[model samples]
Target: MSHRMERVNQLIREELSRIMQREIRDPRLEFLSINAVETAADLGFAKVFVSHLVTSENKKEILQTLTGAAGYFRGELGKVLTLRHVPELAFYWDDSIERGARLNRLIEEANRDSVNPSGE
Candidate 1:
């Protein structure tokens, strides 16, 4: 992506985060945060990745809520952004945190094994 697209992606992420924190009243989308945004090269679409602070049980419920509010979200984006065209927004769960946690556990295990040269 060009510098302009990168900046726009960041702006979209920030604005979406702010909107979730402030304006979105859907109970299902509660405890959600914008994790990342990827805008298409043509700037016609944006993939908005969100993380749910809620437990795994509620994650699906929250995603359903977000999907239901997609239209409203796009409208909100249009209102909040000054762009001539607001890209179509697609919400998705970001599992990067879970992957990071798994990687951390593996690293810790490796470090422990390294410290104990002989398995006792």
Candidate 2:
């Protein structure tokens, strides 16, 4: 995790977010959020973590859709960045936000139970 790699990852994340907002027309990607980006030091491959506020019932399908659009993202990257070698894009579902929300709900439930032990 050198400084250069970190900068590259951040640039990728920002560009992906911009592409999703201004370029993509897919309905399935309307709510998608580019959570994070991780690229190899050699700039050969990248993993883009995507998250959404919507339900995860069809999470697989959503990721598959994004994977299908990887080529488009890569092309856009090539147009935007001046790097000699652009990383291959790979989409992954990031469940961190969902997990954090669930954890918060559980904590709230525990607090409620503690305050109302009588269960009225």
Candidate 3:
């Protein structure tokens, strides 16, 4: 991506994060954070990755809620941005944080087993 593309991606991420925090009042979205945004080269489409402080159980519902809210989000984003065309938004759940936590726990368990070797 060129410098312009990178800047556009960052702008979309920041603006989306702000919209979720302030504009939306849904409880399901309260814990959501826009983790990153990937805009296409032509800037006609974007993938918005989101992370939540909430638990895994709520993930699906949160995504559905965001998906339903995409149009509204894009409209607000378009109004705020100076771009001639606002990219279509696609929301995706970013599970990297949760996956990392699970990996850490597994590593710790493995180390503990190596040290003990038997139930004590």
> What are the RMSDs of all candidates, in order?
1.7, 1.2, 1.5
lDDT of 1 by residue, 35-97 (tens): 888999887988989887765567777777887877887888888788888898888889888
Residue-pair clash count for candidate 1: 0
Question: Which lDDT value does model 2 have at 52?
Answer: 77
After superposition, the stretches of candidate 3 with alpha carbons farther than 4 Å from their true spots are: none
- Lowest lDDT sum, 10 consecutive residues, model 1, at 52-61
Q: Please give each candidate's TM-score.
A: 0.88, 0.92, 0.90
Off by over 4 Å in 1: 118-120
Best candidate, TM-score: 2
lDDT of 1: 0.84
Least accurate stretch of 10 residues (summed lDDT) in model 2?
A: 50-59
| Best-matching candidate per lDDT | 2
In model 1, what are the clashing residue pairs, if there are any? Answer: none
What's the lDDT for candidate 2?
0.90
Each prediction's number of clashing residue pairs: 0, 0, 0
Which pairs clash (backbone N, Cα, C closer than 3 Å) in model 3? Answer: none
**What's the C-alpha lDDT at position 95 in model 2?**
92
